[model samples]
Target chain A: MTVEAFLPRDTTALALDADEVAAALLDAGVQLTRNGSRGAFWLEPLLEVKVNGERIAFGPVTVEDIPGLLDSLAAEPADHPRYLGPVEAIPWLAGQQRLTFQRAGLGDPLCLDTYRSLGGFAGLEQALAMSSRQIVQEVKGSGLRGRGGAAFPAGIKWQTVLDTEADQKYVVCNADEGDSGTFADRLLMEADPYQLIEGMAIAGLAVGATRGYVYLRSEYPLAAEVLVAAIERAREAAYLGQDILGSGRAFDITLRIGAGAYICGEETSLLDSLEGKRGMVRVKPPLPAVEGLFGKPTLVHNVLTLAAASTVLAEGAAGYQELGTGRSRGTLTLQLAGNIRHGGLVEVPFGVTLRQLLEDFGGGSLSGRPIRAVQVGGPLGAYLPESQWDMPMDYEAFAEIGAMLGHGGVVVFDDSVDMAQQARFAMEFCALESCGKCTPCRIGSTRGVEVIDRIVNGERRDENLILLEDLCVTMEQGSLCAMGGLTPNPVRSALAYFGEDFG
Target chain B: MSAQPSSKSVIAIIERWKDEPGGLLPLFHDVQAALGYVPPESLSEIAGALNLSRAEVHGVLSFYHDFRTAPAGRHTVQICQAEACQAVGARALAQRATELLGTEFGSTSDDGGVTLEPVYCLGNCACGPSVRVDNRVHGRVDSERLEALLAACRQREEP
Candidate 1:
């Protein structure tokens, strides 16, 4: 364990700060590995040197601080960088109880050896040893909910797929994270692809499935490349192939590139896209579990859901289960995005208040203005006001308050953001992006837009405002999918919270 | 004789995506890439191509809020408005950019140099206020520094 302690403020944001940090660490004499960010940007310039069993992380370092750091450690300016600190002690890194994003921000996401060293495929090994029921039980015990927004039970979905008597069950990992404020999925795919692969493999084992496909957004061409390469590596490693580890059971996965449609992030829409159809929302009744991904019993899971499954399998579900509150179990990777300090994925147990997310890790508003409102979930989620900051981060909790934990996306808005404008944006957004599968979402969205515009233009604003509410109700219940249903979240929540702004 | 482009919505998008599967994403990509926008004409075609009704295509496009139909400028300058970028002043930068360009997001400049788009994130978290011009990402772009990046597109008709 000769890995020296990486002192605080030695490493920070990588790549963009790579040259400066490298040149600085060089001045200090310790070589810095310009690796991928583990989805932790606040700890930029984080330098990692493996000791014995663990990799040490030092960061939030700058080019200017290198001289003092090197001299303080008494290391040659180009020799051993000072033992700054341990990887776990860094406050920003320490704060996050990473579950699904457990492997991200560690090292080169492309390196197979690195992934292997970090207990990546060990879950797959465990899955291979267990029966389908046992594997499902393990995930079920873990109480892990989908990190992708829906917070659906991962194990139950897998179990359903297993119960289905279909010959060709499929595992579809929804990596087309089109949410406005979340990039954790992309980060996971890019930084620790093996985690996702391991998650899918565990899913396949539980579901008795033999095929897996990852529908990644085309917006992430680079993540796609990494996933493609990781898939290849896994295939070569016997992690994915006709026969798994000489066991009769076989599971293989393919990378399906999404054209970057937000609707495809929806499971059924994703299935449609995977099936070579326009990314239209599919009506759910059979759900994807019975009929999904080429009309077979498919286990449609989010990247985070599958990644968490790996964690549960490797560490035992109880270990994760014992962490969080009722209904919401284990750690949640809350992508603390939008106008905030220390912005990145902050994984904590469920039940943490939005206030903590905003005031604590987020460090208040980024614009230094009084925070007006926050849009939880994603573009489709409700805009909660400052008064609602006490709301805990739980599915039931959000649901009770007319909101959602959709995809763990937290988009913040300072006072500079106009609620009227954001409200209008909801209808406008719906008008522009709806799949138009139903008349309610299609026609209502246009009508919603017209209503909002009339209000803004001060034309019969009061009557139009009432009509907008009525329209939202129709869209919410009448629309086929989330597009129309959740579209009014921003508008309604904004109206509810920021009514003055609308006027 | 040069082929006169068909005014039929289904005819045009089908012509583009008939060769491709993964209809929604690939078609959206092709349409956006080729026309620098997802035109409504193609939107109807996207529906027919996927065997979805016209309303379905319209619904899907409108639902997501990311897909656009209008034309983009010669160069697309996408400034990440996500949390990481915002922390480094992307909000102010986006405001300045939109103001400087004299056009809102999704609209091309009259001169056709660049169309500024507000992207969520470019995965360049560390850089903060990252901007992608066409395909090249410029990290840590400040107001003064943006000129140097935007200046490169002055000569090009499109990238």
Candidate 2:
């Protein structure tokens, strides 16, 4: 009998030597098929064996454990210490809504047959039946917004691109997920590349765009390879290129790799990088929706946003709109990471609180120390203290508390963490990554770092603290893009919550 | 110290991508893949072939941290020093790695065995402090794991 097992090809799984484990399993004469992770990261190198149509999971497995695991595979009861029973029944994964990431940790990442069997291309098949206007209406009615931290309504951007009378329209997916502690974009791209391709293709159909681009970060080499291979397969299968899916529409995507600039995560800077120029922020008024990518009407959406597009269309507006709460309809792929015991990807409805993510999903601090602070969003995101742990994960709720749910990456910090150093690192990060397009981001970031250093050392404590606050405000209000604008978020939050550290 | 990708190969790479609009980035990736780094000599050739100036090519290469103008050592060891990695004691690991290697970040060892560099993050935040040996990333690398990895790098370097 053939035994099917799921093993993640993700960076985390790779770090745990999942490849070596696979090799060991093969050498031991065990037949296994590799599948994407189940998002139970604490248990990664999480291997699952198929039995009776359900997958029994085992993990945090090493090459050392493979022989024993294989021996028990043919045992009467199929009992193993690492066995976690059915994958979906695992409490950590059972609770996730997983709309955008529906196929995230399941099928063979590189196999088209696996993707098809798991309901991958069904959305695009459904989308091919709808008119562009109807597609826009469905998306708008679904209340889908940009998942790349900006939180702008996706339908509005698509509509603008649709309305614009450009001879050439483009759909761009911002896969430059530079935010620390976020792997959802990488996970999706590597695990389910077709989901993104399907969404981008649908976006093209909706916006009259024949060409699409995915600006993938260079950090994710594995994801780039899988996506490129997947796109090639997609074109061969007629899901991309001329006459997609027998429809007369032509839409194709090219993968553009980003160099090591964090500023490129900003949409305009990403465009500049795509043009093979310096990744500097561009002045707005004519947003990318009006004039973008060689000054054409471009629809720019985050990897998660575009990946979720097909699902929105597949289930119709009402099915998607029915999930989540208030204005934040639909699920958010919350990346629980950093110094947390059970860190991994957790996609749930928008109303889940930060406390639940830390306690329930993350299972508190990894170091056994008390959890002190958590940075929501990316590097530029605010560092919330324990006092604000009850804050809901919704966009508006976070905004009300002077925080923005920028790309749903929650980086936890144990009591051992020094907030002063974190704040300095934030400034340092901005200084290193600032594109030098604007004065505040370029100069203010370095200046912010110097002032913070002074505060950390024994300088004029009260005055430098005031100066740091003022510098943060200037960067926040004066900078042209989020690179400089949001650099102050972490700095200010560090001061507000952990003021004693700064002094 | 060794042979680089021939000029013929570089030209072929340029010809393959030159016709596309804004194709320099992808072309650069191919060139880097063939030759470990984008040699200065090839930059002028690429610029001339692609209808771009030398400054434009240079600007593009210098802007991204991934593009290395100089050739790297036999092995490249990149340690994650970002906030997430730092929270999990990457700073100490980085210091120990540098101390053991007898070289600092962005510098190669005396024997030219390995090049150590500091990367922001490697997307293994949950399991970091992470380090990358060549292209493969290893997470949850404590001092012992780092020492072992460095030893492996040295062992690989020896004949």
Candidate 3:
């Protein structure tokens, strides 16, 4: 019998030399299958072997360890130093409620047979029989909000697109995940791409859209390859092209790549980019749901949100609604990044406190230093001090504390962090990335950076701080999009909590 | 340096994507992929084919950071400068890369071996500080590892 060995083909795993490990395993006469990451990145390149119907885990593996590891596996697998028992029993993965990411890392992501056998297209199959209104109602009943930082009710957007009478409607997947600490979108697309395809197809059926577009970022080359291949496979299987799944209903998806713009992640800006124009934020009078994508109603959702739609349909609305806290009724895909010891993806119910996620799940700072600050959400998110760690990660709770759980990216920083510098960097990033469509974002960001520099240099520090706050207010209230409106989150939070850093 | 594809070939690239809706971005990407960077001369051809003005095409091209008007070095190296990478010493890694490369960000090396650029994020934040050499992304990078990567880029130039 051929011994089966599994290794992740994830970008992170590749960075850790999983390909080299695979070559060594193949040379040792083992049958190797490339799988997706388990999101336990600290244990990557985590290698697994199927023995006696159970996959045993061995991790942080290197090519040098392969000989000894294979030898141990042949002799007594339990005796291996790197062995971590069955893959299912790992506390980091087993403890969380994985709704949207249920099938992540199970098998070859592109294998349609494996995907089908593992209950992949069940949601799409179910959606095939339902009416458009029923589908929208089910999503509404599930309390599913937009996972793309806005926290807007996804069902309402779908309802608007469904109700709007347009000759052409578009389903756009906002795969331009430019958030700093977030990799969930990239991980999901790279790992379980079919789920996103199914979700987009379902959205098309619900909104009477015959065509869909995935506006992906150019940075994720691996995801692009996987998605391109997966889309082709899906089209060949009749799961994406016209007459999807033999229901005689027509729907198809086109993958468009963004040219590296952070603002394109915004819905209107994404639409603008998809139009082959400058990725400038459009005015919000006519929402994308009404007139979008070349003057047609468009259903734009984030990668995670679209993926969650599949889960909501498969498990039923009540099944998904039973998991989370008020107004946030599903598992949040929290990405632990930066100076954390156990940096990875954590999908848990919304009520879990930031402290539990940072300590229990992440194991605190990687440098063994005290945790100074944690930036939740993306670049536009607030920097939270330790005092607010106990707050639950619900959208309402975060909003109550002047924070938003934008994209659920949790970036940790150690005690050595300089909040003032971080604050300045936030402004500098805005200045660099602003689309030049609005004044506050275009001009105020430059001014904000300069004012922060003056304050840090002790040139009329008190006066500069006040000026910085005023500039932030102008950017917050006057800016056209979140790119400018939310620039003050990191800046204000850094100042409010770590005032000493400025002086 | 590689020979720049002639203007006729550039028009063919534009012709391939001109009919598709929202085709300018993809046209630009294909042009840049075939030729190391989007040539400024092709702007008129792209605009003419797509029924857009030269300024319109130029505006879209210049708006994005990815579409450069000139050819890059033999190898392109990008270091993540986002907040997550910053927390894990990406700033120092970037500094080290520039020092070792003898080139600043957004410039090609003296030997034409590498072009250094700062990227916002690579979505590989957990294992960062991340660095991308050409198409492949490597994580948990440090000064020593960056030197080795740059050394390999230089080594390819010797032969």
Please give the lDDT score at residue A101 for candidate 3: 81
Interface RMSD to the true structure, each candidate? 5.1, 1.0, 0.6
Angstrom error of the Cα, residue B34, model 3: value is 0.5
Overall local distance difference test of candidate 1: 0.74
RMSD of each: 5.7, 1.6, 1.2
- Model 2 iRMS (Å) reads 1.0
> What's the ranking of the predictions by DockQ, best on top?
3, 2, 1
Candidate 2 local lDDT, A1-503, one digit each (tens): 76667777787898889999999878876667777775667888998878788888887889888878877877842477777778889899988888887787787887888888988888888889989999999899999999999999999999999999999999999999999988888888878889999999999999999999999998888888888899999999999999998888899999898878888899999998888888878999799999999999999999999989989988889999998888999998888888999988899999999999999988889999999999999898999999998877899998897898999888998988889999999999998998888899899989998999898886997799899889988999999999899999999999889988976
Off by over 4 Å in 2: A76-79, B1-6
Q: Pick the candidate with the highest DockQ.
A: 3
lDDT of 2 at A503: 62
Each candidate's TM vs. the true structure? 0.82, 0.97, 0.99
Error of 3 at B50 (Å): 0.7
Which candidate, 2 or 3, would have the higher TM-score against the true structure?
A: 3
Docking class of 3: high
Model 2 lDDT tens row, B1-159:
433435777889999989888788888888888887888777878888889999988998898888887788999999988878888898899999999999999999999999999998888888889899998999889999999999999898777
